[model samples]
Target: MRNSTALALAALLAGAGLTGGCGGASAPGHQGTPPKTGSSDINPQPRDSLRKGGTLRLSIQQWITQYNIGQVDGLQGDGASILTLTEPKLWFADDNGVPAANPEVLVSAEVGTSGGAQVVTYKLNPKATWSDATPITWQDFATQWKTRNGSDDRFQLSGTTGYDDIANVERGADERTVKVTFKQPYADWQTLFDPLLPGSAVDTPEKFNTGWIEKIPVWGGPWKIGSADKTSQTITMVPNESYWGTRPLLDSIVFRALDSTAITEAYLNNEIDQAPGRQPEAYRRLAGAANTVMRTGGRWDETQLTLGHAGPLADVRVRQAVTNAVDRAAIAAAQSAGLPFKVNTLGSHFFMPSQDGYRDNSGDEGRFDLERAKRLLDEAGWKASADGKTRTRDGAALKLVYVVNGNGSTDLPQLVQNMLGQAGITVELRKVPGNDYFTKYVNVGAFDLASFRQVDNVFPSLLYPVYRTGGDQNYGGVATPEIDKLIDQAGAETDRAKAAELLNRADALLWQAGHSVPLFQTPQISAVRPGLANFGAFGLRSERQYVDVGWTR
Candidate 1:
């Protein structure tokens, strides 16, 4: 669910996910360091070398209501950990985030120039079909483009990066082929039409919004939803009998929704096969556990505070003040403790430390200074309370609710609350159930400050949706005209280095405006059971043969 094509294709972060880091660790071993780049601790074995049947049990932070990742309500972080199993991943990416056609769904994708525009033609596998036997055709591609191209206000979307540049999607060489002509040059075009939604599911605004709620009605991947029970908070995935690729080696894959604490216990009790112990506290707890291998790698994610565009946060000075009030280095140190790598405070929104374009563009705005924080808040006209407590303006208290999905073992919510309080702002901590966190709150901008991880993609320009004005994914809704132009130029630039330069320039503006407070990049810390092939901390790589994941022979 993460990669790059024209722009970057990415996912949300859920659970107690260990995020962003530039360095890699040693090969996975008992109490050993996390694996480095070009190495994923998933003991991958060829299908012939794997066992016939087994269940890969894993835990997720929440149960998701929406099944479509393209929709606003559907873009849960844990939702990503499951959708690749049932949806079409037309392109598979390598460790470097370079994408290539997947033979199961695509035969070839050729790029060419058409009448001053860039056109990409996709050749679909004639054998590929949805779970209901609907062939994977040009219609599916056309529907996705229509729904996600930012031309329609009726369709609720997560983000329209590459899709926004599409001029049209037409059938080419019959129904199994699609030719997408871009309105402008989209440098990351290879990322479009991925996880292609069924045409019927998004043909209309009504169907697009509600068709996939609480149900996965159609699928075109290695596995199908066997059962999705909210009562049990578990999703059971079985092999898709109609899948036109290598048969899935495992009999089933089960995902159980458990809180952070429960997931830790489930792994230690041997009830689950994989556990994410990315934070220092949990990482130490699971380290050297009997019969477990701790796979560590570069996590291309940064935990941050997404400020709302509305309310008092709309003031740039207030946003910058709140950002400066928090101690990012302390949080990084807390999370990095006992880890084999040094976790640096994240300073860029678009690139992770592992990527080439990464730069500390934060400048002085990223530093922690209580005096500066108070000065900025005071300058913004939020006067300190008469009693020397919270700030007040026009007889109203300057208060904010910090919405969180899961209170990680790191106690990040508490730390942020205490620090913001010191700056004379009353921070209220509200814990939402994982299932409702995005749909009920964050997506709608229900909090002043929301805590989560922003998973960076290989292509920096793909972040346009997260930073551009009126972009749906820009939950904070903070953007200057200068930032927008830089992001636009970057997204259109075909040159990688030039595009990275433009992105960094735009990132500098975001820091000045306090779009988000980047805490630190996370690490891929997972305690995986022995012999679980092709499944572990995948690091910068996003593709895995879900069908090939099984117990090693």
Candidate 2:
């Protein structure tokens, strides 16, 4: 399973609180081209048009087991998605995932260097307080730092990228101000504190990992947990009376856990007000529904193939052959066929095709060339059997176990299996429980190959935990000194241009190493009530203002 910290930060930044600003030129010091408005199927509704006092019933793929996003058990995307509603970060991203100061939580945040060390000072809004009326303080910041800084293994932190580099977290003259000093420069420091765990949650290891299970003892955002029913597979949330920002327009939000297969039906039956339109059949079904609008856009999440290094994939040639054998374009077409909007195959591992700095570094390896794939396998000593249906090396057949959570359409994996079989590769499909898929298979290296999607970050530093050696989310167990040095160099560089160059260089090494194969970007698809404001499939802007999502008239 991915660590809670990096996953939380990525989900938060990619899909946290919303900010105001139209598309503009790339920010100074940032690399890549500026974000494009791009193709979107969502019908925009003005915030002022929304009415107040209603409950929004939403569908979630999985029931959350842990309330704290900082713990390993709570690192799942479903938990992070829920936390976005209940936990407010000091800094949030605009619709484009651009880091923006959140005045609701922080009055201002300034970054600079002092004594050759990078420093960040945050000034909190005086009115900001938790649900219990506890004022957010420097203690909260310090508690989070100490608990997640990797000093104590018992805490089970999701990541230690920026936290491990932190030398000290000091409070200023008052509780409203806190200063953070990093031993080395962390260019993406602004992305650090959105899903900040409260002092009560992080004060002890037991509290950090177990206290938040099924119960949210603290709240810092616009809403507070009202109740959760495991039997009903539902969680209810109410407006936080202590909230200092705009009062939430909706009386409450009910997140109901539903099977992915049943989500579209739930939407159709009026059991849920919104459902993701990822499946073409679902989108087509929802398209004709009354009082509903189909929204589609380029999502930050990218589907990829992760090969385990400890199993049959340990041979780099095998990984390379597999990469060349799969046809990404065909896969994208099959997934998006007959859909309302077109979807594109993702080329880069780090940036989206539309984003700045994105390049097709996959080279010839990404193409679907069975000849080259077979040649590579032959070079690696995997000879075709007499039947020519599968390859064998030293009497052991080239069999690969492909595992996935039994959710949504199986077309992707089934297609991959069929394609690989044509190239004499035997792929065994293993479906795991969606709830334990990450922890049981992906995290523990229980399968030869796995398929999953990841949301990209605005800055490259967020990639550290996924590609760096010994990273908490390094699924493939890729460890190389060259890769490590390049990643560290990129993280420490203050100059965005230089960092982008270093990141691109490092990406080349990743492709050469065949760490993972980039498949295609999942089109952000959703069916929403026509009057539903501030809620739908968004591009770089994934965060929604929970307080503002409601019906219009």
> Who wins the lDDT comparison?
1
Q: Residue 429: error of model 2 in Å?
A: 0.4
Q: Could you give candidate 2's per-residue lDDT for residues 141-168 as a string of tens digits?
A: 9998998888999997667778888999
Q: After superposition, how far is residue 266 of candidate 2 from its true place, in Å?
A: 0.7
| Model 2 TM-score relative to the real fold | 0.91
- Model 2 CA deviation exceeding 4 Å by range: 1-48, 542-544
CA lDDT, candidate 2, residue 334: 80
Instruction: Please give the range of 10 consecutive residues that has the lowest summed lDDT in model 1.
Output: 5-14
TM-score of each: 0.91, 0.91
Instruction: For model 2, give the RMSD to the true fold.
Output: 6.4
Model 2, 20: alpha-carbon shift in Å?
22
Model 1, span 366-457: residue lDDT tens: 88988898999899899997665699888888898888775344288889989889999899888877557666787777888987766636
